[model samples]
Target: MVEIEYKNARVKLGDPDLVYEPAEDSFLLADAALEDTESGMRILEVGTGSGFVSAVLRANFENVRIIATEINPHAARCAKKNGVEVLRTDLFRGIKPRSPEARFDLILFNPPYLPTSEEEKVPVWLNYAFDGGASGRETLERFFAEVRAYLRPGGRILVLISSITGVEAVQEKMEGLGFDVDIAGRTKVSFEELVVVRGKLS
Candidate 1:
């Protein structure tokens, strides 16, 4: 279990059989986004396990609508239990925009980017957070391709990527996709390299 305080609200998270610290990078990324932009904008939280980010956003942004997505039903349930309206979507596939021209002003994701090992098959419990594909770039690739369609002009995307998964590879992909990317925050934990990257639609 991991605990974090975002916008003065406490959130507790537990994922069985997986080791991870929740919401630190996500909060840093979100704070950067909220600080750098004006408020009352539409926000989307991808992979919203337990609703920590969504709950914090709801508390901070008045007149803002939060659309949270979780691929795992259990996570979705947990998010809803925290008073967030969560959508069950595989990434952005099932999420429909409010209108043909509607797009999110801020998009956030804490994706599963831990590179898998050949010595072990991914455990089912880790599926909600771990199991990034061979190079750990599969989910990021999909987000890069599809997110453009859902992002407003000049909108920003904040995401967490682990150094173990090759941040440079993901950065190159985002650059190739025409995004202006920069590392907004980072923390070097004993066993993990965590960072938050902010991407602006260019």
Candidate 2:
């Protein structure tokens, strides 16, 4: 069990073997993105660790409905306890709109942007939440490839990438995918530089 305080909520995380470190960057990125959405926005939160972002969004938006996805089963269960519409998914698999007509106005993620290193002590659940493959961009690439299918016309996506993961490389990747991207916010942490990238689908 791990405990984290985020967005004024004490969230308990359960994972028998993995040590949970709350990603402050993830929570901050979600807050920044929420400012840009309207009151009734439909939101999708990817990687809903402990449901911090979902809880915050629920509090702020009166008519908002959040669809949260987690790769870890334990995390999904934890998020469900927080009143989130939680689904266990490896990335975006197993999640789709209630109807083909349903789509999200805002899609958010604070993905595992830490580049994998040989020296790091990685546990099973942490790997699902922290490993971004050899270059630390593999998961981002996969998300970008699949995002359009779930987005409403002119919908926006906000995500966090760190300097350790090569922030500029992520921007270039988004551009090559034809998204109009911008830096929504930035913060410096003890170990990494956190930035929120907002991409609008054309």
| Candidate number of the best TM-score | 2
Deviation in angstroms for 94 in model 1? 1.5
Question: lDDT tens digits, residues 1-202, model 1?
Answer: 4566767666666564432335466666566656654566888888887777777777676688888988877677767766788888888878865553479988888887877665544546456577677787678778888887888888888888888878888778777777899997888867778887888885
lDDT of each: 0.75, 0.78
The true-versus-predicted C-alpha distance at residue 187 of model 2, in Å, is 0.8
Q: Per-residue lDDT tens digits of candidate 2, residues 1-202? A: 5666655556666563542345668567757866877887888988887677787777567788788888887777778877789888877888764543488888898888878876673767767678888888888889988887888877888888898988888888888877899999988989888899988878
Question: What would the TM-scores of all predictions be?
Answer: 0.86, 0.87
Error of 1 at 146 (Å): 0.7
Model 2: residues >4 Å from true position, as ranges? 1-10, 15-19, 97-101, 118-123
192, model 2: CA deviation in Å?
2.1
The clash count for each model shown is 0, 0
What lDDT, from 0 to 1, does candidate 2 have?
A: 0.78
